[model samples]
Target chain A: MRKGDELPPLEIPITRTLIVAGAIASRDYQDVHHDPELARQKGSPDIFMNILTTNGLVGRYITDHFGPRTVLRKVAIRLGAPNYPGDTMVLTGTIEALEDTSATVRIVGTNGIGNHVTGTVTFSMRDAE
Target chain B: MGDDPDTPPPRPDFYDPDDSAARPKPHGANDSTAPGPRDPDAVAARPQSGDTGGPAVRPLAGDTDHQTPRPHAHHPPDDLLTRLKAYEGHPAAVAGVGKDPVNLPMIRHWCEALGDANPVYTGPGAVAPPTMLQAWTMGGLTGHTGRSSAYDELLALLDESGCTSVVATDCEQEYLQPLRPGDRITFDTVIESVSDRKTTKLGTGHFVTTRTDVRVGETLVGTHRFRILKYAPAQRKKPPARPQRPRPVVNRDNAGFWEGVEQHRLLLQRCTSCATLRFPWLPGCAHCGGPDWDTVEASGEGTVHSYVVMHHPPFPAFDPPYAVVLVELAEGVRMISNVVGTPYDKVRIGMPVRLVFRTYDGDLTLPVFRAAAEEAAV
Candidate 1:
């Protein structure tokens, strides 16, 4: 991948199952990520997506776009709007810089309310030759 | 799935809304507090939640029946805090032992759930993930939490004081040694601190922190510090129209498979070049770069390969205590879906299941499986 190359945007439909599945899978037992009633009691309108799930999804996006051959070296992200159930998160990546076999991608995942996650993913691909 | 052209049908699609409806029933699972249809046999058969493998973990704190406002509002903050403070630095659990020794099955399950592929977790001389420090001590749902009566009394006091809603605020762990299979685990916990009444965006409550020291045969393996916020649930928003179930994204490659579902057919892709059978409609064969493929119908016969029951964080759209299962078809392929006909706990590994189409929210339709073998009741 070269600087300025754009990876196709992946649209993820944020579902309740996916949210809960993602949180549990990460071993994060935070209820705000899964329980709606508790979430409301805590001031949230509903359960929201945890950061690890967003990180996992971003990694999946990069691997899917760069082909499975790429190795994800690092993921640095800052969460913004919370991804609530029934919303959709559209992830778009742009290669901000490239050096040797490694590429740095700028990723933004936005949901109905606003940008849920923004970060940089750096990955390295092996040369087929 | 009935066409029978010699190739097996497709596995249920994960993205399909209809597939998400299989609700797991709570029997011995500690992850959920929701009551659902259950069987006595299941309770006897299944290990308490927190067993090493599938569907084991769920949020722990704030799992109680406190939605209704307590007639007596707010216990005096000073009194509650004073009583809560009395437990500080007290031993909550001592000589607590793990249900199972550190083993590969649990490690494998943890890796698979998180999609972690680090080489250190598997193969020869593999060590369990260091992050699994706390899991080793959660003794199963058989009321073996290894807690001292004081700790139990402390939580009971908090519950009685009306802090119903819970959210885990933070966790800190320090790994001193790597845990491996065959190693026995032991731990001790102390009530580290309980904070005074505090207000945050989520609500107003006190913060409870517990520190645990985990050991493998006297070798200090790790230390886990956990904190949670127990707040009186705020009733700011009226429960809205139960949120509709989540929908799937249908693209060109998987469109035919969904269309087949619409027609009550489960279709599998038969690669034209290599003639390999593939579940979950994909564009090309991984076996060969074959560009084209056709469809085949499944026999609607499969066995449960594995499963996890969801009991916590009940969603508005989906009910708690449902089973999300992985089944291996007779054709040697696997897919994920919810099991409908039996209680979530009743579903077991190697049990037979047959495919059936289900619709949710009055409009969404997808394929689900019902236990094919006759239940003891049936």
Candidate 2:
């Protein structure tokens, strides 16, 4: 794929089950990720998405676009908005640079509040044709 | 970040790959993420170094370095690497305490998410899941709860050297005692070692390892080692052939089931004398001692009964942090399989699923279920 190509967007519904599952799956047992009560105690309005889960979803967004053979070499993201339950995160990507087989993608995951995650992912894919 | 990103380059655990142009491979997808003996051995395999392609991975590629000439950009590569290596055997944490004690609510939530029904995690005389040794001590969003200055310094050096990006590669844990409720957890971490620069298909970087000792007061409970691969992408090498899946055992009793899978049909055994249906193709019926049975094709409708998500120790040709579920079929039997057509986190208990025989790496075919929900997302 050439630089400047846009990946198809992915919309993920954020549910309580999704939040808890993502937290447990990534072994991030922090109370803010699974316990709404503890989350309030920790100053969050509700349970929210963990960084690891965001990383996983970003990886999924690319894999969905480039086919399964896509290899994620680096995922360096920073989170802004909290992904609380009932808010959906829409992920969209733009290929910023392509050199040989390596492609650098700028990814953003936006929710109701604002950008949930914004970062760059450098990945490669075997000739997907 | 503990997910293995460099294992045999996995298929989308939730999205099936188009295999029309796919070639059969050599590593078992099932074997890649399974917590088998391979994970511990892999914790020692370091990332390698490579300098090729263009200037994509050059230090300070990120525009965030707005400051004037940095000292790291002028130093020799060996001197910087030597400084990074010097931190080995230094304390990464000093008397670090878990933010929370081992409790039942967290345990219950963990089991519910994993769909693990083992009675040991709950009820009276309960103990936490052995896999959660490192979970209790996690720093959460307020990171570095117990981080020492030395560990931070090493990471800063790596960051300044143009290896600012990082992803967790893998982890190994060994439990010496059960972690029970009400037990306060404490741990000590040390910089294990910094690898010589290494290269994988992903890029060139060093594998940083840290060893942790978990304890309840003075008694040692377990040991854990986590690997973080600090990397920047380099040359674009032709991707290796897709790795093959571990072959399923096909013995005399189960051979017919595998044969049925090969033909893209799920087969179940029906007892001739007792009319009892059985899964897994046993030699005889449970009710009657009749060795005679007939094959019945399953209609492939099912619901998720129980499930687990794998997120560590990635293998060749498989992705971690993906769901593996036990599905209860409409025919009144349950079988273990993988899910496609939905993100793994969206898989829930009682979710409807339909059976599909999928071929991976263009060769190995297995009876897997696809999420039946019609959603607008990929």
Candidate 3:
């Protein structure tokens, strides 16, 4: 990976199953991710994805590109907008900085509403080479 | 790779009036469309309204169906939040011990459930997923044996004050070491801080935060900070519709497991070369580095190795405080599943259990365990 290189974008079609399965998989029991009516009552349009799912997808995005040898050092991400079911999220990233053994990649995941996730991931790529 | 062949098409919009056949209308609501077969269970779960004519009776403070009122009606007293400050730094859960050691089986189940195919979670030098740090500290069905008295007191105080409902807002975990199988884990948690009175769409409440330090025989492995809102559930304009359980994501690597459930059979994989059995089917053997594997039908006999009662973070499909068990199959492989036929608190380690297939949705089936012992018959 080199600075300014654009990582291929991953498009995930959001579904109720994806939201709930992702929540339970991450051990998150929050109702907003699984219950549409409950989520609506809580002010959201529908069941939306949780931060953990976003984080996992980000991890998968980077690792899928760098191969299995890459070890993620730090994944610092912030939530932007809610990712609701029936919406698709497209994740794209750029290598912001490159060193001899590691690189810093900035990522942004956007959905129908707006940016769902934005963050920086620092990973060790010595073995990835 | 972008389009997973196994993914089922998305369901139609729930609120679409034309799609009345897709979802059942809420009870007592106007039905301009054809009536479909209604689930009695769903009707039973709906909160009963005392005065249907006056207004929809809001669920009790802790009800999972609790709704935040469209307009703010109440704001908690600031002094009440100040009193909560006294409990800050108080021990929440203490001497919390993990009933089982950090092992591969649980890790595999987690990975399979998450649709995570990361190679680092498996193979010869595999390590537990960093995100699974909290799972290691879970007390299982019996629950945390040594909960702090102060923590219980705080909850009682909140209940008395009518802030009885609770929901986990979020959690942050920091892994300091790579945990390997066979590592014994232990942890202690303290109420890190309590937020001032605040109002959200859910209701008025304070955010209670706790910090837990997980260690393996004195070596710090991770730090987890969990936060929740203890609030009085607000009333909704109308009764909310029942929520549905999310379908599991089955991919190529783990499609066999779900298929086994459809046939009401529990299957485990054994490496064709080394004969090492695994709860989750994998392409290659972790021990022998073999590329081939075969199936072994499980007897379904097992014991509750560990478990947890998810009390907070209430969801529509799940009732709060239900017991989810980790079963050690007679086949000698442990798997994460739920224990039925017993109260959540009655579940314990070493309790004999038997496997049973449960159907959640129209086409979803999963293997769950039920307690074998009844009336304390040892």
> Which candidate achieves the best DockQ against the true structure?
3
DockQ category of candidate 2: incorrect
Q: Score the docking of each candidate (DockQ).
A: 0.05, 0.04, 0.09
Better candidate by TM-score, 1 or 2: 1
lDDT score, candidate 3, position B78? 31
TM-scores of chain B, in order: 0.45, 0.44, 0.44
Order of quality (TM-score): 3, 1, 2
Cα lDDT of model 1 by residue, B1-378, tens digit: 122222221211111122233222222222222221123332333233344232322222343233332232243444355456545665577789887888888777666654556665688878776556666676534544566765676677777777766655444456567788988989988777777666554455677888889888878877877666677654546455467888889999899989988999888899999989998878889899898999888877888999999887676688778999998887777889888989988989988988889999898898888888763346
> What lDDT tens digits, residue by residue, belong to model 3 across residues B44-131?
3332443223123222233323333322123234324434554566567777887678888877876765566888889888888776
Per-residue lDDT value at B231 in model 3: 74
Can you give the lDDT of residue A101 in candidate 1?
65
**By TM-score, how accurate is candidate 2?**
0.37
Candidate 2 deviates by what RMSD?
Answer: 25.9
RMSD of each: 21.0, 25.9, 22.0
Residue B219's lDDT in candidate 1: 89
Regions more than 4 Å wrong, model 3: A1-6, A19-55, A76-87, A92-120, A126-129, B1-76, B139-142, B155-170, B231-378
Clashing residue pairs found in predicted model 3:
B140-B307, B140-B308, B141-B307
